[model samples]
Target: MNRQAQAVVLLLLGGAVIRACFTDLYLNYVKEGLRPFLIAAGVLLVAAAVMTLWYELRPVPRAAATGDGPGQPEARAGGHDDHDHHDHHDDHDHHDHHDGHGHHEPRVGWLLILPVLGLLLVAPPALGSYAAGQAGTALASQQQPSDYPPLPEGDPVRVSVLDYASRALFDKGASIGDRRVQVTGFITAGPDGQPILARMVLSCCAADGRPVKLGMTGNAPAGLADDTWVEVTGRYSDRIGRDAVNDAEIPYLDVESWRQVPAPKQPYE
Candidate 1:
């Protein structure tokens, strides 16, 4: 229909596909978390595309062919609008490209504005550190029988991935240090020749998660792949190292065994 409307429709259709496909990851510079909102935005795009196509395909009524006569516009069997709407412009006749056989659709340019407004006003939320780097990164439901098995009821000093993470970030490993604890994550390389220490990040899926690695030396020499899940059992030593993004060695657990686990269903922090 109009130039602006066509642009809007095409934009919405294209944006939907891009967001859906790439919404898995965000900026590499920032160790971030999975962005569920962007995924939702992508879904919206697909819906907008379908609506645009529908409006374009709808048919509209064409003027009568026999009406070279007096004031008669879209004539029907029963009388409706009695007012003489088309008396002056009776002589004016617009030519149709096709023969009067097929019906024509009015430009549905009006519908395209819906998603355009959404895109402009309310963009999707971004992957933030709050989501991925939080202390409580693991989901309880995703826990397995013994990924980091529940400690036998004894001193009750064993901390868990959920426990350490859920605590205040400023608290460090204060509560669990020198106590038995367990965690699960992917195996990543530690700076220097340090073995045993590895990093594992949890994200919404595998995409938007910030890398939260458990530093343990002398574990796996080959290290681990980019995204491998592992279970480590050790004491929560509060030895501050660096940050996850900066390769900073924050205090990590001493690993007993970094068992490789399957990627859980909800792969997020």
Candidate 2:
């Protein structure tokens, strides 16, 4: 293929890969082995785009002067192909786009998406006490921390996911002593750009994962936009709730060091 044609293909693939990465339905649809596949796809797309840009800027070969067929279109002496009078390069020439460039209409993936989207775009009660009671499904823990060496006492400590879940559920933040912990995940924020509490999800393994949010509290780190992976370190504090959870069943962390991080392979726990 010509350099221009090749560049176009690369650009198309890159755009499709990016859309697949960002679109929510794409996230959910390609829900298994998505991290690796998406990452690989992204790298390929980037490489393609770079190659395209390079090719686009590259000088084309000097037109071997066949002097233009007497009946054919030819460039003027100064070298800009004057197409002002030409019908050969018509205004309506078809630029067939590849279907692999995964663009889709605004169709909701699941039927419940309409309501979910409404809740997101507008204000809706957060998934709270109502959901707490229903999310009692069994999750298989792949390995226990006991099998690994314990983190030595330092400025910050390593806490188990089990411990974190329990503390959040029962003691809230009151039970934790003066200890700092670090957790990392993709950033998810509110429309107003507050750091919303979030959870990492898994379909089969920790591969095809996306983040579901909990709630946002206090001022978030400046310049940290949603879906940007970050490493957050802070003290876990409890926020007492109203309703059934009013009896202090809420535990969360007060964020401290929120630094951007690269996406990990097994992004979810």
Error of 2 at 20 (Å): 16
Relative to the true structure, how large is the alpha-carbon lDDT of every model? 0.46, 0.48
Whose lDDT is greatest here? 2
Residue pairs in candidate 2 whose N, alpha carbon or C atoms collide under 3 angstroms:
none
Question: What is the C-alpha lDDT profile of model 1 across 163-216, one tens digit per residue?
Answer: 554331335545443555556545444444353322334433334344344446
- For each candidate in turn, the TM-score is 0.45, 0.37
**lDDT digits (tens) for residues 140-184 of candidate 2:** 222323223333486666554335535554444434556776666
lDDT of 2 at 203: 57
